[model samples]
Target chain A: EDQVTQSPEALRLQEGESSSLNCSYTVSGLRGLFWYRQDPGKGPEFLFTLYSAGEEKEKERLKATLTKKESFLHITAPKPEDSATYLCAVQSGTSGTYKYIFGTGTRLKVLA
Target chain B: EAGVTQFPSHSVIEKGQTVTLRCDPISGHDNLYWYRRVMGKEIKFLLHFVKESKQDESGMPNNRFLAERTGGTYSTLKVQPAELEDSGVYFCASSQGLTNEQFFGPGTRLTVL
Candidate 1:
């Protein structure tokens, strides 16, 4: 069965602190992996997409790296505005529908 | 460009009632999708539409859920005889093509009592 698991369900960090969130997935024929940031009362905002192992993508203070079995979202010197639920999702090539399997998100709080 | 939009940000209904949610995708996006996230659970796929056709509905939970994308533009999800378990946030997303990253709309939070 295809599944996604995220660790450190919640995290608190003083502003400027750095941390990483983990997303481990088990799927048949991986097609793509995605990262999203969701604010309270709003839908998820797209961040980056990783298509293969050893791939990495970055935007401003965020960097995402992918491996065969897992992915990590590294926040560098995060600000309060960066505090949001970070979500990880995977698309299965075998599914054919291009539907996503999402992990329960990691809630991060960057206190100023 | 305008992002995806959903109607009725929140709704409260009694069990066995009917509720309909609407979504307007970004212009020209050919693929529309429905997803739901129950409290404390991951988001789950409900269905997908390519233009006005139901491309994939294998994720829909049961027959009580009906989704339609009329004219390949906006879409609606109707839940008939809702159950308490139906309470959750319903999200809509769209992309230009199958491989494009989907842009999501602010979800509709449904409450059933």
Candidate 2:
């Protein structure tokens, strides 16, 4: 069975603090790993897509790195505006109808 | 360009009532998806439509849910005789071709009394 799990269900970070959220997965075949940021009452916004192990992507204060069995979303000196639920999803399957499994997500609070 | 859009930001109905949620994907997007998140639960995939054709309905919870995308344009998810367990936020997403990046809508909050 393919499943995704995110650790540190909730995190409270002081402004300027740096931390990392983890997403571990077990899938038949890894096609893509995605990161998204979701604010209250709003849809999730795309952040990054890591396709292979050793791949990394960055945007401003956020960086995402991938490994064979897991992914990490690192926040560097996060600000209060960076507070939101971070979601991880993995697309796997050799068949044409791929399955996208999502983690429970990590709620991050960057207090100013 | 406008992002994906869903109608009726919130809906409240009694159990056994039917509700129809609509979504208009980004223009020219061929892949549309429906997802739901019940209270205290992670969002789960409901179905996927590729140009008016049901590509994957395996994630759909039950037969009481019906999804349709006509003319490869907008899509609708109708839940007939909705149950308490069906109360949740319904989200719609869209992508182009085989692209993995999917844009999502604000979502519709459904409440069953």
Candidate 3:
């Protein structure tokens, strides 16, 4: 069974604080790992895709790193605008179809 | 270019009623997908469409759910005799190709009494 789990279901960070959210997965075949940010009443926005272990991607104050069994989304000096639910999904399967298994997500609040 | 869009941002209906949700993907996108997120749960895929064909319906919960993309354009998801458990946020997404990133819509919130 393929499963994705994210820790720290809810986090409240003071503005300008740095923290990391974790996403762990167990899948049959590893294809890709994705990170998305979702605001209230809006669909998730794509953040980054990590394909292999040791791979890392960054955008402004956000950075994402991947490992064999997990992924980490690090926020540096996060602002209030960065507050949102961060979702993690893993695309993996032997079948030809593209299947993404998602985690429950981490709700982040950056208070000013 | 406009991103994906869904009609009727929200809907409230009684159990056993039918509801149809519509989605219009970005122009030229050949792949469309439907997903849902129940309260306190992660979003789950319901089906996928490639043009007018149903590429994958493995994730569809049951036969009461019918999805169609006539003429290879806009898509619709019809829930016949909807159940209370079916209440959730239904999201639509689209991509140009198989491996490309999918753009999502604002989603439709369905509430059942």
- RMSD in order of candidates: 1.0, 0.8, 1.1
Error of 1 at A9 (Å): 0.4
TM-score of chain A of each: 0.96, 0.98, 0.98
Counting only residues 3 or more apart in sequence or on different chains, how many pairs clash (N, Cα, C under 3 Å) in candidate 2? 0
Mind giving the per-residue lDDT tens digits that candidate 2 earns over B10-104? 99999999999999999999999999988778889999999999999999999999999989999999999999989999999998954478888
Clash count, one per candidate: 0, 0, 0
lDDT by residue for model 1 over A10-106, one digit each (tens)?
9999999999999999998888999999999999999999999999999999999999999999999999999999999998855447768999999
The reply for model 2, stretches above 4 Å from the true place, is none
lDDT of each prediction vs. the true structure?
Answer: 0.94, 0.93, 0.94
Worst 10 residues of 1 chain A by lDDT: A91-100
Instruction: Give one digit per residue, the lDDT tens place, for model 1 in B47-88.
Output: 999999998898899999999999999999999999999999
Per-residue CA lDDT of model 3 for A1-112, tens digit only, reads 8999998899999999999999999998888999999999999898998999999999999999999999999999999999999999898876558887889999999999
Winner by TM-score between candidate 2 and candidate 1: 2
Give the chain B TM-score for each candidate.
Answer: 0.99, 0.97, 0.99
